[model samples]
Target: MNNFQQTARVGLFFILGLALTWVTFETLRGGKVFKDQGYNLIAGFTTLKELKDGDEVRMAGVKIGEVERTRLAGRRAEAVLRIDHRVRIKSDAAATIVMAGLIGTNYISIDLGTDAAPDLPDGAEIKTQATADLNSVMSQIGDLGKKLETAIGDLSGALSGGKDGKTGIIAKVDLLITENRENIGKATANLQEITAKVNKGEGTLGRLINDPKLHDELVTTLDEIKKGAGEAKNFIANAQKIVDQVKAGQGAIGALVFDQKAGEDVKASIANLRAVSDKIARGEGTLGKLLSDESLFRDAQSIMKKADRALDGLDDTGPITAVGVVYQGLF
Candidate 1:
């Protein structure tokens, strides 16, 4: 090959090597070329749930880092996680392994504590949250089944093996069934007789079910009651309507209740009557003067007397003489 061809082949191989390295790094470790921000937290639990190294550590749904190691620490299991230093986590943050999706791979989930508190120090042990362990759940279910079996066995023993050998409640019940066989047959026949009577509409209760007239009467009575109730409702509604009219000043009672014009007319009439009363008290107008003045009363009395005397004289005097007496009396 020529020198240019050799240089070209070397460049292509170098590019291939770089691409392969990138692919390999991505396969080995999750995430892109640029490292994400995170923080490391420790959680100790009895079971690690098969959490493996290189599992993603997430905080508030954002990828932070990977699990570095897991091992038995003292009486508890510990998982070492390498997290991005740039990620902010609280001292109370929780680290847990959670499944990604249903039937999917598991990932490390870090619950970011409330942002109100200060960030946790590097490699600091954080707060832990315990979820239901699969083995523990199975054990509890098995214990529940055992308790149920114990309860059932106790009940069976109590029923079958009693303190009394022969006179237990179940044994007494069986003896009673055996002794009352013929009496039970007679009682059963009596029950059948009663049922037949009821089915044939022979008893009062049966007639209540089978009689059409009583049913029709009941229906009619209900209809009448409904009609009465409707009428009562209509009457109440009309009364309410009348009350509303009175409130709105639409009728005679309404005018008395809310009519400003009627009130003003009444006030005007009262004022006129008061003026007339005051006039009477002061003896001002003709009628008021007539009512208040004693002199006018005396004058009226004298005029009535003169008329009576003149009428009495006319009974005795002739027509010409009566006229002469009246003319003289006037003069």
Candidate 2:
């Protein structure tokens, strides 16, 4: 009976252990019993971060598969992830580590590329991305600590003036205040006085702000100015009437601007001058005859050309040769 009791107790303990192991396996597998239902892809990262075996492989927000293995490939740590065969990953799929829960294990996360992209092949390398975690965050905070130390050092130096016998920020501020104290007081007093005057009403500005009489005066002045403008416009209208009379030839200026007979006379004189110019151009008068006489023009051209040739040869011909040419021409 003692042997039987002992045997029963051992079996019970073994059963409990099996049950616990199954439950642990189920939890790690993310409630999936068969792991071969997914397609496999590989990715590489420099560090594992906190990822583990049996971590869920999620695409977007949906659970797709499980992580198969994590191993060192050369200098990079690589992970083999199995995705649901039904969930087709594109050729450009990216994977990163993500926390499964607040305190749960980290999982492999995938970003699905656009539908227009080609499907990724089995065993293809899914691009891996580094995810920030506690270690990176702590490293960043350490750098921040150093920056904080530098900022504090600079602030201390500025406040205490670089550990030397120089005036500090407080001393400079004090000196500035001392130098400008009287001017600051005067400015403050002036501001106070002006504010008081504005409140009580005194100058033209005060009248514009606080006096009904000033408002009335401004309105009256505007009305008077408007009346004067109306009178000026009336005067301009009468003057325009006089100008219209002048344009109608009822005055000296009118005759100058609008006399039709004078215009006709000017047109006749212009016509006569144009006729004379035409006669000259056609060689029908003295000027035209002179211009159109070709033999006379040729003679003059020959004389001018000879004179030009003589002048061009002057330096080489000598003064005696020039005198001989003038004498021969005279003969």
Candidate 3:
């Protein structure tokens, strides 16, 4: 019976030792006893962003593998992923480091590539993309906060009109009001006077404002002006129509201006007129000589004087005697 008890105690101790060994192995191996028997894929990135080995490799939020190791390759860092053999990753699959939470661990996340793409081979290099680090995000937020604070301070300063200069909006407005105070007072007085006049129905403007009949008359005048504008528009349209017809070679003026034969004829007539004008200027024609000759003018004046003396003698003499006398005078 004692031998049996000792044997049972030895068996219990062996089982306890085996359980402790399993627990330690599970802890060291990230809860998986058998090292992930799968294909390895390489992913390179500028930064790992706190991604460590044994971290989950997820596809669409489902754990599909684990990050096997991380090592520096030349200037860049590379992560080796052990993907489950059952899960087929396409060659175009991209891997990126993702934070589980704001203060949580980081992991490898992958997008499910299209099925049309070929399956990636073992030991293939998967594409990697860098994500914004928490530190960088915090730094950018601090910078943006500072800029916003500056803008708010500037706005407050502008509204309060800081005494630095006349650059603030409130300061400029106050300066303008101070300079125009007298003008503003005059304007206010004028407005009050105009209001009194309007109430009493004084001037044409006041009457128009106070009396419906005058308002109606003004409306009628405005309607007449509108009618006149319409008539002017119609006149302009008619003029435009005429211009368009001329442009289209549809009118007599258009034909004279656009037709080659009519233009040639006009040119020939102009040439003839120019030639005649030139001849006249040079005293080449009868009319030209009549206008230009001084001898003809003197002869005309002498003839007129002789004719007057003959006519005067004729008035006092008999017809035959007058004729003889005129003949004797001419000779």
Give the distance in Å from residue 238's predicted Cα in candidate 2 to where it truly belongs. 23
Best by lDDT: 3
Could you give candidate 2's per-residue lDDT for residues 1-331 as a string of tens digits?
6999999999999999998899889777654554456667988999887777777788887888877878999999988887778889987778888876656478888898878879888898888788888767789999999999999988877877755525778667777889999999999999999878877888777777789989999999999999999999999999999999987788866775699887677789999999988998888877787788887788778888777766666657888688777555434
Q: List the residue pairs that clash in candidate 3.
A: none
Native-to-model Cα distance after best TM-score fit, residue 177 in candidate 2, in Å: 3.2
* Ranked by TM-score, top first: 3, 2, 1
Candidate 1 lDDT over 1-331, as tens digits, reads 9999999999999999999999888767654466555555676877778677678788888977788667789999887777888777787778777867555466778887887888877677767666765667789999999999999978776666566645555776777889998999999999999888878988886776789887788889999999999999999999999999999889888996698889889889999999989988888999888998889999888877887788778778878788876765444
TM per prediction: 0.50, 0.53, 0.63
lDDT of each: 0.80, 0.82, 0.88
- lDDT of model 3 at residue 222? 99
Clashing residue pairs, backbone N/CA/C < 3 A, model 2: 283-288
lDDT for predicted candidate 1 compared with the true structure: 0.80
Which residues of candidate 1, in runs, are more than 4 Å off?
Answer: 1-39, 46-49, 60-62, 71-76, 99-106, 155-174, 215-331
* Candidate with best TM-score: 3
Candidates in descending lDDT order:
3, 2, 1
Q: On residues 1-331, what C-alpha lDDT tens digit does candidate 3 reach at each position?
A: 6999999999999999999999897766654675666888999999887888889999999999888888999999998998998999988889999999888599999999998999999999998788898999999999999999999998988777667867788888899999999999999999999889989999987888889998898899999999999999999999999888888887788877778888899999999999998888898898778789888899888877887888788888968788886786565
TM-score, structure 3 vs. true:
0.63
